[model samples]
Target: MLTHLWRWTLFSYRAIWQIDIRARDPLHAARRAWDIQRDPDSPATVFDIIDEFGTTFRVDLAEDNPHLDAQPILATPPMPAWMARLLPRRFRRHRIRSRP
Candidate 1:
């Protein structure tokens, strides 16, 4: 009976996205998480989440950092649509421009 229930639960379970803050230095990670949690409007620079099952997921700091402007060129405008289409499939340009 237990085996049958477990199988049913597993089949019905949906994966949830959570940040797991289990770094080499958990204290630092915890502090960062707390800061983000405290300020609801604060942009999350670093954090992790744990699921109900105790599974943890790491949120990439580099990807989350607002200061790090590394958005994909395809996502941005200013590049001519024709030029972007003309570029080779293998070529990807995502350079960060310095602001004056």
Candidate 2:
């Protein structure tokens, strides 16, 4: 699948970090963001997340910090409207192949 560089904005009482994650989409990026955040203290939380198209997502992290809402926010999908309009139907439906 095509990998996009996503920005995971981490918010903590200690500090804030803009973590970069490469993944197929925002959902994958959110998962990876939690994984990346494991190294830090528990105070750290996902403040904001954005896809390549810059669409913001409200990622609700669980108490254990594993599970998340199926829909990003208000039933919004990972891909943004702008991207959906830009890409072809097939490209939007199926993931693009990525090179090693």
Candidate 3:
């Protein structure tokens, strides 16, 4: 029981962290979320991940995305759309200025 309780606590903390990381950097968070998806403790379903990407990145194509119903999706900045191919990923994430 004690071990299970401890594991649940850890999972809660990790879930919060995963949400935070996804906010700051979706790519890295995807990697981390993938890792969590493979782990036994993850409560996230495939639907949860799909929702996360669609909602967080505003890539909602489905007419029934749950997050889309709750709030309007935020538009992505124009520059970052092609910036990864032009600039390295790390630099592109930080460089929010208009193209030079």
Leading candidate by lDDT: 2
- Candidate 2: C-alpha lDDT: 0.53
Worst lDDT 10-window in candidate 2: 7-16
How well does candidate 1 match the true structure, expressed as C-alpha RMSD? 16.2
lDDT of 3 at 28: 76
In Å, residue 20's CA in model 1 sits off its true spot by: 5.0
lDDT of 1 by residue, 1-100 (tens): 7767864572221222334575568788877667665776755545343333333344445453533233322322234445666667665366322111
TM-score ranking of the models:
2, 3, 1
Error of 3 at 79 (Å): 1.0
In model 1, the clashing pairs are: 19-48, 19-49, 20-49, 20-57
Which of the two candidates, 1 or 3, achieves a greater lDDT against the reference? 1
Query: What is the TM-score (0 to 1) of candidate 1?
Result: 0.22
Clashing residue pairs in candidate 3, if any? none
Clashes in predicted model 1: 4
TM-score of each candidate structure, all chains considered together: 0.22, 0.25, 0.23
Count of backbone clashes for each model?
4, 0, 0
Candidate 2 residues 23-90, lDDT tens each? 99999999887877785555455555544433455544535664544344333334545656688787
lDDT of 3 at 94: 60
Model 2 ranges off by over 4 Å: 1-15, 40-100
Candidates' lDDT values, in order? 0.46, 0.53, 0.45
